[model samples]
Target: MAKIDKSLYSKEEWLVIRNRRRLEKQLKKQKEQISYPVKRKSSKVAFVLGNGVSRAFVEPEVLSKLGVVYGCNALYRTFAPDYLIAVDVKMILEISKSGYQNTNTVWSNHNKAYSNIKNINYFQPSKGWSSGPTALWLAAEHGYDDIYILGFDYKGLDDHSKFNNLYADTKNYKKSNEGATFYGNWLRQTKTVIRDNKKINFTRVIAPDNYQPIELNNFENYNTIHVGDFQKIFDIS
Candidate 1:
């Protein structure tokens, strides 16, 4: 378990470091061929849920908008999203016991403890990816044209109290800012993906000010809406 000083690296700088570490790890492991899941249907828009301040504003009806929902980490605890992604062992254990059988869960190899869990898609970590980045990659690979991400605020990196995920109180998770640096890595990695894929437009809905818009069309125009506003805007009721 190596660590990077969060104080020393900007989010972008940390991305460089994280990518290097991933390459080194892959080289050491000889790059196992991974069987990626089949590309999902090409939905016009998809939602990627993150645990952030705005997470409290989302309702189950907003997630039930026919648009595919890709939730990361503890999101499944609150809503049965269409897709769930996790790289943490504790989260995997929690989801396994939750008995919510609708979503397709994807877990990285960070914790191999849940490999025997049937129907859960296990992803081979290629170059040190986190849950959020892996989920974005899956959406992009699946040919989704538009992706709206929610609750992915990097505010906790500066203000620890903003780490208010629903599952923070759960066992094995710190009730405070347990992994701010890691969250920053996810942000940086997601930024890289958004920049690399010009065809796929990535939109961060209800994101905090710290998250800048990527170089995608209509990104600047995408308004950050509250739950009520989102419901009204999308006619979710």
Candidate 2:
């Protein structure tokens, strides 16, 4: 924990901080530490990313069959998800105000403003991770046998635009052509995490041909499958 600047924060502010810490500590104790390769019940889960391609390619019917849909960033604006996640401080704070709905929301432990929000889960990641990959890790921890990722286009800059995400306009998120810098780093870290946990099967659902498969060391864990196959795998109409 970083040393708090005592001069900057008043007693009330300090009290809130201490209370939040206490709450987070309690939450951590109750968190389930899911062991890998323990069981395989044929559960199918989908993690929907903010890339524009997901909006274009993945259909609602296919998403409905994926057992659960974990929406990233501003996905709530476009589609309803069983779980909504945000690790970015700004996005968490923003969504906490408006989209606090029936869906289960998981937020970073660093953002204490989300404390009062109902149906919210707090997670303290072992390392600094971006929202998408972190969501993958969390899903694996929850024991989903098969995980599908949709709209995870790694293209940070197209030939024409700086915007990388589909919901940037609605969420007021900044667009950068240099998406490869930050987004690329996140992908590498996420791939490492996926490689470490090989028990869970991960499929990139109907991604473009340009988005190459994330290779694992000493194993083949990741693959690309069509959205139609996603429906068949889960037996969803």
* Cα lDDT listed for each candidate: 0.64, 0.62
TM-score of each: 0.66, 0.67
Candidate 1 global TM-score = 0.66
Please write out the lDDT profile of model 1 over residues 1-237, one tens digit for every residue. Answer: 388787899999989988999988877675444544543544577777777656566674466555777777776655676677777877777777876532455555544587677667655544467777777777766666777777766555445434555556567566655654345677677767776667876666663344443433334423444455555656665
Question: Best-fitting candidate, measured by lDDT?
Answer: 1
Q: List the residue pairs that clash in candidate 2.
A: none
Q: Which predicted model would earn the best TM-score?
A: 2
Instruction: Please give the RMSD to the true structure for each candidate, in Å.
Output: 13.5, 11.0
Residue 42 alpha-carbon offset, candidate 2, angstroms: 8.4
Model 2 residue 127 distance off true place after TM-score fit, in angstroms: 4.6
Which residue pairs in model 1 clash with each other?
A: none
